[model samples]
Target: MSMLIDLEHVTKLYGNVIGLNDVSLQLSSGVYGLLGPIGSGKTTLINLIMGQLRPSIGQVRIMGSNPSWSGAYLRRIGLCPATDVYLPNISGLDWVTNQICLYGIHRREAQRLAEQALALVKMETACRNPMGTYSLGMRQRCKLAQAIAHEPDLLILDEPFNGLDPVGRIEMTQFLRGWVKQGRSLIMASHILHEIEAVECSFLLLTGGRLLASGTLSEVRSLLREIPNQVRIRSPQYRLLASRLMGLDEVADLRVERELQQLLVSTDSPAQLARTVAKCVAEENIQVTEMRSEDDTLQSLFSLLMQLHRGER
Candidate 1:
């Protein structure tokens, strides 16, 4: 099957500084989150994909065409960069209309398309006002208007949530989700894990100029099973629960939190530990007020992967 994006033995450099180091990955046609901390080459990777910067070594294929030389392939992709382009003097409509005209479209036709784009992003009314007078959320909506005016098949976003309030963030997420439902592809880059999680897409994790991992949430979560897990259990009979858990071979460590009335269990086998806990709850009548896995969260998983990458574990 043809890949949406592909990189082989890719490395990017700025003098001695490595922008992306020996990274290789393939992405299919679907929504994907480009996840990383700041200065982790997320923007660099996006630039390479967008053909703004050619890789120092290795290949970059976007929609079966190498971005390095395939200028025509650009029209197939839409990008809303992380950098804020505040054209203080220009109206939102003019800015977006000008962007569409870059694809060799006539001014009148581009203007019409730009109108639709602005309307889609709920900024058509305020589009006539100078961008400088617009709020950060309004400006971001205008930027999105420009990017989508051409109606590209692949939508790529970098930090698309930077200047939005809670309501704006929800609206932006809903809009992107609607985009995917229309059978289009998307790649959204963000440092905030929950924002990507809100979009509910597979993700590619990058750090220190390296591609650490890529997969759907469940696929990635399965990796957690290979490593030990820390599960927190709170109960009325905390001491009895702790004693019962201590005898299990899978239980690697145990800690008691007197204030919380919780037993923290570190276990290599979470499944077995769960069975034991259930047995103790039913047969011994131990009251478990709360039983939760501390490491089950996406943020914790990302932290674990970061630790593994740094050779800390």
Candidate 2:
């Protein structure tokens, strides 16, 4: 099979500021997640893949050809950028039709395809109304409609679930999942880890314009497992609980908050810790008023990964 995207020592700089720092990666066609925070070079990498910007140093190839060298290659790719296209005057149908026309399809065919795409996104009901009158979520669906109307081989989406409600988010996820089942390629950028986790794809983690890690979801998660995680439990028998937890292999450190009657544990094995806590509750009759994990969020994970990258771990 042909390579989908190949980047060799790719570095992008905007004057003195680095956009991407020596990112060398190769990806095959399927589905992928570009994960990072603000100013993490996620947009920079997407732009490079879309041929919107050429690399300042190194090489970028899409489908075995240089993207910047020819615009024709773009005909086979689709993009749904994070930014909104605020055309207050144009109706959603007209906007979508015009976007599809850019792929060289006739107006009639473009409109027909646009209608189908809109319907798929559940935007068919109010599609004839001006886009400016629609909500942010509606605009997102319209953007999605335009991107898929031409049925491009590779679809790249940035923050596709940004403005969606819970139900809308579910619909959007299902739509993308169906798109992947058709054997097409996809690259999606988002900071919400669980949403990407639900879709199940390889991940590229970026921070400060550097790619810290790239692998399948399980592989990346295993790296996270190496770091110490925190769990807080409130119990009246805090002293007894802390004493028992100190002996477990899973608990690396334990502290008791006397005033709050809470036990704070630092552990690498949260599942094992949970089991130990459950046993204590059943056999020892230790009452647990509350229990929660603190370091499970993506922000904490990213911060810890960055620290690991810098050899601070």
Full-model lDDT for every candidate: 0.88, 0.90
Q: How close is candidate 1 to the true structure, as a TM-score?
A: 0.77
Q: After superposing candidate 2 on the true structure, give the runs of residues whose Cα lies further than 4 Å from its correct spot.
A: 234-243, 255-262, 282-290, 311-313
lDDT for each residue of candidate 1 in 1-313, tens digit (9 for 90 to 100)? 4588899989999899999998898888889999888888999999999888899998898888888778888898899988888889999999999999999999999999999999999997899999899998898898888888899988999999999999999999999999999988999999887789888799898888988898887776576565678899999899999988886799999999999999999888787888999999999999998998887354556667888888998
TM-scores, all candidates, are: 0.77, 0.90
Give the local distance difference test score of model 2. Answer: 0.90
RMSD of each: 4.1, 2.4
Candidate 2 clashes between residue pairs 3 or more apart in a chain or in different chains: none
Best-performing candidate as measured by TM-score: 2
- Candidate 1 runs further than 4 Å off: 222-303, 306-313
Candidate 2 backbone clash number: 0
Clashes per prediction? 0, 0
Model 2 RMSD to the real structure?
Answer: 2.4
